[model samples]
Each structure stands twice: as C-alpha cells, then as structure tokens.
Target: MKRIIITCCLLLGVTLISFAQKRVLVEAESFKDIGGWVIDQQSFDVLYSSYLMAHGMGKPVEDARTTVDFSEGGKYHVWVRTKDWAPFPTGPGEFQLSINEKPLEDSFGVSGSADWDWYYGGQVDMKKGENTLVAEDLTGFNGRFDAIYFSTEEGDVPTNDNEALLAFRKEMLNLTENAKDVGQFDLVVVGGGMAGTCAAISGARMGLKVALIQNRPVLGGNNSSEIRVHLMGRVDQNHNAKLGRIVRELDNGDPGNGNPDADRYGDERKLQIVRAEPNISLHLNTHVYEVEMDGNTIKAVIGRDIATNQEYRFEGVYFSDCTGDGTLGYLAGAEYRMGRESRAETGESLAPEEPDDFTLGTSNLWASLEREEPSDFPETPWAIQFSEEYHIDDHKADWQWETGFGNFNTIYEAEEIRDHNLRAIFGNWSYLKNEMPEKYSHHELAWVAYIGGKRESRRLMGDHVLTQMDIQDGVMYPDGSVTATWTIDLHFPDAENSKYFEGEEFFAGTKHIKVQPYTIPYRCLYSRNIDNLYMAGRDISTTHVAFGSTRVMRTCGMMGEAVGYAAYVARKNNASPREVYTLHLNEFMDIIESPLSIHNLPTLPQD
Candidate 1:
C-alpha cells in the first residue's frame, strides 16, 4: 500500500507538470481596457505585476477586459491572485472573475493573505482561439487584483516566490531578455515630482539631452493633481532665488489641499513646460525598476510602462535619483539609511538615543463638500472601526492625516501603510455619514487621494550628510547652492490619537524648532560610492533630524536645480559629480546665479 501511494504521488506530480506546461497567465496591467480602475504599483516588487485598484467610491466600477490566446480548448481552472482586503470575517471588497462574458461559479478577491495569494475561480469551458477575461468589481471598496492564471490541470499552480514568479511570467508570456532601447541622454531623471521636473527642465535649459521618467501619468510627485499636496516652504531665499523660477511656473496658485477638482494642481502647466523643452524626453507612467551598473558607475536604467508592459532601457551619462525613495541609487548599490539614528551615532538631540524605525508617514488626504440635502455613504464593514469616543469629524483632510510611522518600513511595507490609511478614511467617512448623519447630513466626501503622498524613506548616503547642527549654525559650503527655509518641522504620532488607535494612529503631531534659512551644500546631492549618480528630493544625504527642514517640496525642488547645474558642469567638462563639486565649484556657481531661461516665473498675488 505504501509503494502504491508513492507511485500515485509520482503520477500526480507528472500530471501537474504537464498541466503547468500549457498554462496561460495574463497580467492585469497589460489589459487592453482598464475602465474606472487604476494601476497600483506599490506592490510591484512583491507581486508579479502592478495590480488594479478600485478606489472606495461605493458604486461598482467598470470592468477590466483583455483578450487571451489559448493553446488548448475545453475546461480550464481560473485562479486570481488577490486579497480578502480587511482580514476580518466580513470582507466588503468582493469581486467576480468572468471569462468569455460568463461569470465564474466562485467569487474571487474575497480571500487571501496580506501579501498577494491566489484564489481559485472554479473551472470554465473555453474555445481554442481568442478569449476574453474580465475583472468585474462587485463593490468599489478598494478591491485589488494582480494577475489571473488559467490552467488545464487543477493541480498546476504558480509559486509565490519573486524569482520563480518572475521567471514563470517571462516564460509563459515569451518576454524578451533585451529591453527595448528608449533613447540616450546626458541625464536621466527617474522622478517627475517637484525635484525631478525641475531637474529635467533645468538640464534641458542648460543644453543637455535629458530623459524625464515619471511613474504617474502627470508630473509633480507629491504636488501632482493625482496626490494634490500643496507646495510648502519658501523658494524666494538668499541662495536659492535663481533655482525656483521653473517651480514658480508650475504652481497652480492653489493655497492648500482638499481642492474639489484635481486640475487645481496644474497638471497641464507642468506637462507643457516639460514638453516645451526640445532636449528633454518626458516618459510619463513609466516606472524604473532595474539599473545597469558598470563598476561604481551606472550605465543605463530600465523602466516599464505601468499601462502596457513594454520595457524600455534609458542610457545616460549622468542619472538623477529624485525618486524620493532613492529608487535608482538603491538599485545601483548606493549606501543609504532609513529611520532614526541613535544619539551616539548622529549626536543630535532629536535622534532617539537608540535607533528606531520611526520615519514620517504617507498621507492619503481627503475632503468633503457640503450640500443642501443629506448624502448617504455605503456601509464599510471591512474598514477600520471608529466609535463615538474615537472618530474624526473634519470637512477637509490634509497632510496631517498620516500613518506608517514605526508601524512598518515605509518602502518594504508601502502597500500596508497605504491600505491602512484607506481603511481609516473609509471607516471614518462611513461613521460620519452613518453614525453622525445629523452633523454630516449635508457633507459628501468630494475627493480622497488614492495615491498617498509619501514624506520620507531611504536617504542615499553622500560625501556629506547634512545634520541639524548645519541648519542651526547656518553652515555654508563653497558648493552651497540651495537655501532651505523651512524650520526643523519634525513629525511624531499624535498623543491624543495614539490613545485611541495605538500603533495604528493616522493623525500626526508636528514639533517645530525654528532655524535660520541655511544654505544646503552640494556635497549632499551625489552618491558617495556610486560615481555618476546624483540625488535630489527627500532622499538627499541628511541626518533624519535635519531632513525635517530640508524634506519640504520647495527645498527639494531647489535641490533639483542644483543637481541639474551640477550635471551640466560634469558633462561639459567630462568629469564626475565629485569632480564638478571639488574641481569646478566656481563654474557650477556661475550656472546657479545665471538661471532664468526655461520658463517664465508667475507673478505672486500681493497679500
């Protein structure tokens, strides 16, 4: 009987392998039509592809449909890689998987792990030719679906390991190893935020061929219409006045977040500026994930379109990692640090005597519009629970509605942080509309940011790490080109909110320490080990305590300007970033003082 059991197990394994050989996998992001759904790249590293996210708007969204070529006919088992969403018994975010216009017997997206896992969709009959697959969302309560698998054998399942999953995807899809060459440039800016947009524009104006790669469809990272973060901090300063003319051109004239319309963030104006530049090639919705490293220098960076899965390789002499998260620099093996430092390590008062994972959280800002009639919100049973004792009753949500501090690593656990914020937003909004309808009778949730605005993560180590001492004493380097005007505005979990939510506090408390407007040295902008890499934005070399002041968008934008000028000087003289700082500081300074070429500065309204 034991020998028979072993023989049967071997036969079953052989059958599973045979079935797996003929399986077909469809990447959700590569779907032909993704209506009312958006690509969620927060879990790209963990998941096979960027998944489709349905923002919690109550009503069911349009389905994502794609055509697939099947090699064999007959019944095939359908599997969807998704999550149960809330981890509770009642999962509000449930969706159905349909094939060839027929709905599957079992409902998908209602069960799985915190990370992605597969849910079986029963078996469906299919023709040998072309077939259509649809992700029909039942409730638009932020249900996510990564990819779908169809196999002739029920036992053939895809592995969850990153390498195995990636290899399976490539082999099944017959993807090419060589990435499609996009173009060559003097500089390739990885982000399209305030810093990256400024860097691209500045480089183009300085007569360098530039490639601006933005992960989103629009520019202005945190300040974009998608995220809708109001640009803060000062730009009109002593050393950085020349660095912000381009930033001024892109400002939407809007003062704060919670704007009714996304257009108030000025997506068009930013796009127009980048497009007007003859030398800058702007590739929006392209996410850079891989880097080609040659020794200590980077040769090319590879990116994929989030909409279509087409990969592109961008070659450049110099690279600017304005990706706030230090994405490119990290990919190229650049030294970096995350979280707080010990007092013994940095010797700063703000440094937590012992190191801790306590970085500022990302914000999923929201707002409401008041109407004459009562507005009804659907019950969010799967969302976080907020009682009368602990509920938020605000008409507008802004940067303060934050989470992820010490709860998780901001980069590795980004999806968890964003989902936690979403749960809080939906839960609180539901409470307002349902529990306290009298007070919120006329208020309707107008806009909730699907893309959370991130504050800090992965500061790339550079030749010089700016500290709070530098800001306090107004230390100036010969290569000091940008002035940081924001005070030491560090954030911690709100004590009041923590009492109710403990480790899951969404609101933030800021402690501001005033400091003189200090000049930021250029040495903090380039990687110490990576030769050709330059960094801007929040990821610039800085102690966690000092990042409080320099992490603001305007300060980061000026940092981008400095990076652009440095890139030009490095390329013109055939020198590295370090050489441009040490050997040719004066020539770089000349460029900083003589900028005003790219875009016309908008006139500020008099107070």
Candidate 2:
C-alpha cells in the first residue's frame, strides 16, 4: 500500500509538468500580416454568416461558431495576450475579449488593461482549457490584430479586472435583471408611422394609457424626412373630401393638395405636434421583437432598444399593427397575402390574368436640381452601358426608372430591388452630369432617399377583403368609409426596358373615377383571426388593384383614426374588436366626425 501511494504522487507530478509545457506563447512576432491571418477563406465564411445572423436578429455569431473539443477535462489555467504594438488602433480601445460568448465577470477574479505605449490588454478568465475565446471591436472602427498568445501561469498575464471593464461588457447585453418593473399600459401601438401615430394619439385622447413604439428616431413611416415621400389625401373643407384631417391637424391646418406636382410639407413637423400630446408615451428607436398572446388575443409586446439592446415589455388590452410592414400581424399568426391577385378571382378588370402577374415595383427616388455652373462629375464605369437611345435626354419621369419587375415576389424584398435601382440611378446620373451636352448639364443630382418607397407587402386578411370591383363599382359598405383621391394607377414591370419604356403608361386605362367618396368597412381594418389586434396603412385588406387606390398615406391615416378609436371603445367596454365593429358602428363614425369639427373641417358623407 505504501509503495502504491508513492507511485501515485510521482505520476501526479509528471502530469502537472506535461500540462505546464503545453502553454501557447503568442508574442508580438506572431502578428505579421494579421489581417491576412484573420480574414482567410475559412474566416471569411464565418464572418459572412455572422453578418447574416446579426442582420436577421438571430443568435450571435460566437454562440453559433464556438465549439469545444477536449480529450480530457481538468481545471487548466488559460490566458490570452496581444502584441504590445498592433497594426491598427490596438489596446483597450480597439479590441474586446469575451469568454463563452460573454465577457469575463469581475467576480471571477479576471484582470485586463491597455499598455501605455503599446496595445492595451489585461488578463481575464482563469477558465479551464478548451474554452472558446472571441475578440470583438468595441470602437465603431475596425481593428487589425498583430499577435495573440496563450499561457498557463498565475503571474504570467497582466492583471486588471476592475468593475468598469465588467460593467462595460455587462451593459452590452443590456440585461433587464436590475430594472424595476413599471407595470403595463392599456394600449400599446407598435409603430410610429402615420397610422401608428394617429392610433396612439387618438387612443390616448380617449383616456387610455398609450405607449407609442417607433423603430426610427422620427415618426411618420414613409412620409418621414428619412424616406421623403409626401402625404397624399383629400381635405375635409372640400365637402367631406378631407381624407387626412388627422395629419393636417397635426401639421396645424397645413393643406395637403392631392396633386403630385404640389409642394407638400413633410410629415415629421406634424409628428412633433402629435408628440407633445399629454396621453402619449413616445418610445423612439425601439423595435418590437415579439408579441405575447393569450389564445387569439395579444396580452403584451416585447421590444428592444437599438442602441443598448435593452428589452422592454408593455402590457395592454389592445394593440395596433401600424408598422406598414404588418410586422405585428405577421407575428400574431394573422392571415396575410402578398403579390397580385388573379382577375378571375376578384372579378375585376385591373386584376392580373394569373396570380403570378407582376405587382408594383419600388422606387429609389433622387431629386435633381438644374445647376448653372459647369460641374465636373465623375463618370461611373457602369454608366457606359446607358445610351441616348433609352430616352436618356428626356428629363421628365413618369415612374420610368422604377425597376425590380422580374426579381422578387413581395415588397418585403424592397431592399434588394432598391440596391439594383440605386446602382442604375447613380450610374445614369453620372452619365447625365458628365457625358451629356451643356443644355442638359444644368441637372444636378440633389438628394437620394435613405430607403426606397415600398409599394406592397403582407396585406392582413380582414373580415372583408376589398376587391377591385368594389372600387370600380364605387361600392360603399354600411359600416364606415375613408376616402382616397388617387386613381387606380398601375406601372408596368419592365417599364424601363420596353421599347416605349416598357409600355410604361401612367394612369393607363382608368381615368380618376369620381365616386361619392365611398366608406371603407370597419371589417377591413382588424385581422380576421386575431381578436384584439388591428392593422392600418398599405397592408390593410385590399385586392392588388384596389390597393393601388386605397394604399395612399392619406387614406391609411384615416383608416388609422377609425381603427384607433374603435380600439379605445373596445378597451372601455371590455369587448373584442369585432364587437365594436358590429354593435358600435355609429360610435366609430362619431369619433371621426367629432375630430374633424374640432379641427373646423366639414363633415364626411353619411350615405
């Protein structure tokens, strides 16, 4: 027994010596051409996948990529060290190190710091072997690594695991563990677009606690200064023609002329006026992540701040999907359809012969100003393909540059189409400015919009799907109505490519049909299956052709007002949205009528 004990002690000493010798010594010399090392073919694949995941709001790359492979498990001391001098901005400012996809906790007795003259770094994580390590750039700027080494010795690494470093990484995750619960509100509007803004303000005016969540810094979705699309609707002073009184009132009686040629004031200034309302709690730069539902009814909404990634929950009796994209409706399992409807199905003349027919294309608009100076613009190498044969000299635009006819099926792919159109816009602009004659030289590109204006997306399936026939026949539902002034205009898919600019005729077959300012049914606002949820904007129930007329922002804003008031009534009565649609139709109409009078506008047609 004594001999066996002595033999076991000797073997333990040998194992310790072997583990000590396995240390990885990364030094300054190992960092030569660091970019080449980190961005190799294998690393490129990893990076590409990481970007896709991040953009999709999926799991972090480190969680997906890190793997542990160990033949034996034991407590092995591990440390990472970078070169004293880095290729780029090195030290604490350039790189952030994380363990197990999380930053090392100070409670774990980790340490780190930036070296004064060289790169900054300190020791962290006295973790066991086979642990995953990740280095990220905390500074918005990219960093180039020089060298990194790992050693297994207590005093070998620089120790500086202070509270500040721990807090820095802790804040990145933005965990709400320490945040006090603020309870919930009565109504939560998931978008700050035109419809959403109206929904929150109108609901709040009804004395409900309303929370307005806007993903962007500003309100007014498409009409936002960021996108630059003008609000289009009728004014009430024209004898019930005022389709966008909500926005106009917010704009302080700023008249919105329906003509595209008119100088329409943007929606942001109006949004500011709405933001000052007492009952609305505006949460800007917050995006809705998910909707928590109880059966068919939504109980609460989960949102996240884009800057801090801190999550927030809002409990409410009712919710409105004014995101324009119908995000909330989609999340709540509401039935929706995208693309064109077959003419046979809707029994309308404008409907496509087949369901596969092209829908409206997105536009990447750029405003051009006539310049007097002899401007020297750089010629785009891709612009050589464009020639004068394509009517490049005819400066007038009737939506000719709108591309993406054959590419995507739904407007959700607007970004992809916008990228294609942006290339074309920039390429064409370069030729016009550089190659065109002096007579055409005055036109200079002024501004390109931040995002392309989307024409269509997941239209929520409502109790009544407004067909193209409804518009052509000027059918009025018994419930209520919102008026739109735009004609049933459809643009050809290949307008730019056709011999006559792809047979691209604006306001093609139908002239502006003067109907009696028909009312849109309340059934068309809320989703068919979802109990307490409502949808507004371009994504409401409508056939492809009907949408072309009703999808205008002015009509959308009216739809928002109607549905918003309905939601308030539903909350007050402790009833579902459908109940309000059926039993309290007059109350809904009264709300729309009363607000117009308060703004000193004419009453809408009751018939």
Q: What tens digits encode model 2's per-residue C-alpha lDDT throughout 505-554?
A: 11112244444455677888888999988888888888877777777776
**Model 2, poorest ten-residue lDDT window?**
1-10
Lowest-scoring 10 consecutive residues by lDDT in candidate 1?
A: 1-10
- The residue ranges of model 1 lying beyond 4 angstroms of the native Cα positions read 1-20, 596-607
The sequence of per-residue lDDT tens digits that candidate 1 reaches over residues 47-166 is 536878877567678987777766577887878888877776656678887889988888866664565787788888978877888888888887888788878889878887765777
Candidate 2 has an lDDT of 0.54
TM-score per candidate: 0.94, 0.66
Stretches of candidate 2 above 4 Å error?
1-183, 237-243, 251-268, 370-373, 382-384, 394-400, 409-412, 440-443, 494-496, 499-516, 595-607
lDDT per model vs. reference: 0.82, 0.54
Quote the positional error of residue 290 for candidate 1 in Å: 0.8
